[model samples]
Target: MFGGGGGGGRKPLDYEELNENVKKVQYAVRGELYLRASELQKEGKKIIFTNVGNPHALGQKPLTFPRQVVALCQAPFLLDDPNVGLIFPADAIARAKHYLAMAPGGLGAYSDSRGIPGIRKEVAEFIERRDGYPSDPELIYLTDGASKGVMQMLNTIIRNERDGILVPVPQYPLYSAAISLFGGSLVPYYLEEEANWGLDFVNLRQTVASARSKGITVRAMVIINPGNPTGQCLSEGNIKELLKFCFHENLVLLADEVYQQNIYQDERPFISARKVLFDMGPPMSREVQLVSFHTVSKGYWGECGQRGGYFEMTNLPPKTVDEIYKVASIALSPNVPGQIFMGLMVNPPKPGDISYLKFSAESKSILESLRRRARLMTDGFNSCRNVVCNFTEGAMYSFPQIRLPPKAIDAAKRAGKAADVFYCLKLLEATGISTVPGSGFGQKEGVFHLRTTILPAEEDMPAIMTSFKKFNDTFMDQYDGYSRIIQYYITPSVKT
Candidate 1:
């Protein structure tokens, strides 16, 4: 009854014709608001992209030593130039020569699918140093960025539609998007907002049981340490508990530790899950499979454009690792420059090296500025009428919870938008500050929040805070009696 080209006209591919799993995905970091921001910018509007953790776009400078080394590597002939010493440090020149020797056919050529062997060795050393445990260069699959490695791992893990990955509520949407794209069900476990977005095992257990009841086979769990969006650093005790839970449940652990170097608090230090698991020793370490991801895009490096990152696999079967390698080979190799950056990231200028002083200064300045901006933004959000923000102890974002009035909720419902989306859009219109809605990252049914990067330059924070407060105050005032109710609910009256 159906004709190829005779039924009026052939439809190219509507929503119904596309892959259902692909259609289910949504990435709000560069979603509608960002597009609109771009348009406004073209029309002469000054837009600050707060939706994503892109430090260089916000004026954070890249470090000198890494750039110099990469530059020389890209063009080795520069080393032969008489003025090379004036432009690059002696150590940087030596480093470039060292890496160039490691490269198979220079920067223009494709590398081994697993990555340049020498770089992988450096990554292993970096990990060994960080975790105080041995790491295998063989297990490292260098990709375009941490994202590629994450997607590959998920693709390898997800069997079918019934397979699921336990993702954190208010998680980075990459996990959800990757799960959807790979045809895996996302089982969300809500992080405790009252306890500064800490992981609650009770909630986790409930989520797993619920998914199981619904006939969903949870294969793995994704934990974002020094979390994305919510920005909570998991404690060592919590990490141990998570490992135990995964071990007992026969689940793999996917640790998104890209923000490992972004910790701002003295009290909460970043601990690799590998370190914790190995510390547990014996059967626990042997039994649990972990894939931890890291990137140069976040932290002080902020080399997002370079797209350099790596993921290390621990306790995965050799066959499975081989399969991952096969999948990686399908793409030939990740960009050689990115691979080079990954190598340089793990092994930067050391003590007494020619570039060490400048490297240290550049790195420190960027990190300290981020800390200051985070505190300023957190304070600004807390000062708002119906807003409550947890401290950004780690990571580059502040996920602030906003209490919207019934009227605003109804308006959002009418407009067919999430409550936080409505608020964020209005904020964008009033002031050119673009942020992602909490619903973009999963959240509870009635809760409303927004994720804004604490990444605007330190000097610009005061102006951003002023504009942010002004907009929120005016917006809250429009919705009558909302602030009073939130204040009452949050701080219950003491009846003497």
Candidate 2:
């Protein structure tokens, strides 16, 4: 009627006409709570954005050398300016010149779909040094970010509705989202939250068996070391068990190691899945397929927006790798500048380099600050009347379980929200602090949690925790039968 082709018909891409799978994707990190917080911010409310693991957004300064190298590579014309030497450190300039030489068209050019060969080689060397095993540059796929690599692998693995991937409960939500997007089943294996979110082989075996009983072919299993949200590092023993499980189950292992550099505890230092696999020797190492992912987004680099990441594939057949290459080639290329940033991340300044002292100092300061913040957040949560938090051994998040009483659960029902969601909304409204509800990340029945980042400024963390406590105390009193009485009934918190 309005001179359109369909004459008052519904929009060509109507809601109901959209892909069913698209409608099923749920990423709680930026779900209702984040949206509400954003709306509040728009209305002039001061809101602390901690719903996701984005560090740079919370005022993390980019490392000097990376920015320098990326900037130089982005504008290689500066190298010929002669005065460029005055502005950039010699090492950064030299590194920029090296990458520029590798990429003839520079950052603006579409690199090889597998990423710049030179950068892939750099990543391989980084992996070799990291895992004590050889990495083939041909197997390294530099992604726009680690997330893109994840989706790509998911795409490659999930062939039909019958194919399933074993994902951890209390996952990052990326796996669930991707599985839905690709129209595959997400078979959940619950991590023992009480065990500091450790993997349970019995749980794994049962979950895989259950999936099989339902005719779901379990294709792969994802392991996030120094886990997201939960933030507990996997012990090397856990990895060994996981590899054995994968070998016996004939499942591929997808290791998300984005937070390898973010460990906060010496007792639970980060261990790579590949390292454990190889250390276990022949059949398991030689037979179990593995893909390990890493990114510059989460570490001290905090280059979230920089989109620099790579995943190294081990034991994948040549044809399958070729098919993945074809899928990547469809995108033409990964982000060029991102690849450069990743190169700098894997190969930063050495002790003798001019930028070494400053790089080391900046990285150290950020890490130490995170360490302190993790401690403060954990202790602060444990001190709360109706809250229990395991130590954030690594990663940038602390996912604390909220001990909501029956009355609070009923109140949440009345509010048309999950108990944790209602509590998070209340916390946000009361304290102007934003967080992701536990329901967003899958949790066991009767459990409720909220994930908050430890990325706030160190000085501000104490005040933030204090504010959270004040609001939580009042919230518990108003809904959870008053803290004093509730405390008597509640079990003593566990210390891991």
lDDT of each: 0.89, 0.90
Clashing pairs for model 1 are none
Instruction: List clash counts for every candidate, in order.
Output: 0, 0
Error of 2 at 247 (Å): 0.4
State the local distance difference test value for candidate 2: 0.90
Give the CA lDDT, 0 to 100, for residue 2 in model 2: 54
TM-score of 2: 0.96
Model 2 bad stretches (over 4 Å):
1-5, 480-496
Per-residue accuracy of model 2 over 1-496 as CA lDDT, tens digit each: 5566855677758997789999999999989999999999999999999898888889888888888888888777888997987899889988999999999997898999999999999999988898898989999999999999999999999999999998888899999999999999999988887677887787788888888999999999998987987898999988888888889889999999999999998888888999899999998889999999999898898898989899999999999999999999999999999999999899888899999999999999999999999999999998988688888999999988887878989988998899999999999999999999988989988888899999998989999999999998898778746444333222345531
Kindly provide the TM-score of model 1 when superposed on the true structure, using C-alpha atoms.
0.96
Range of the 10 consecutive residues with the lowest summed lDDT in candidate 1:
487-496
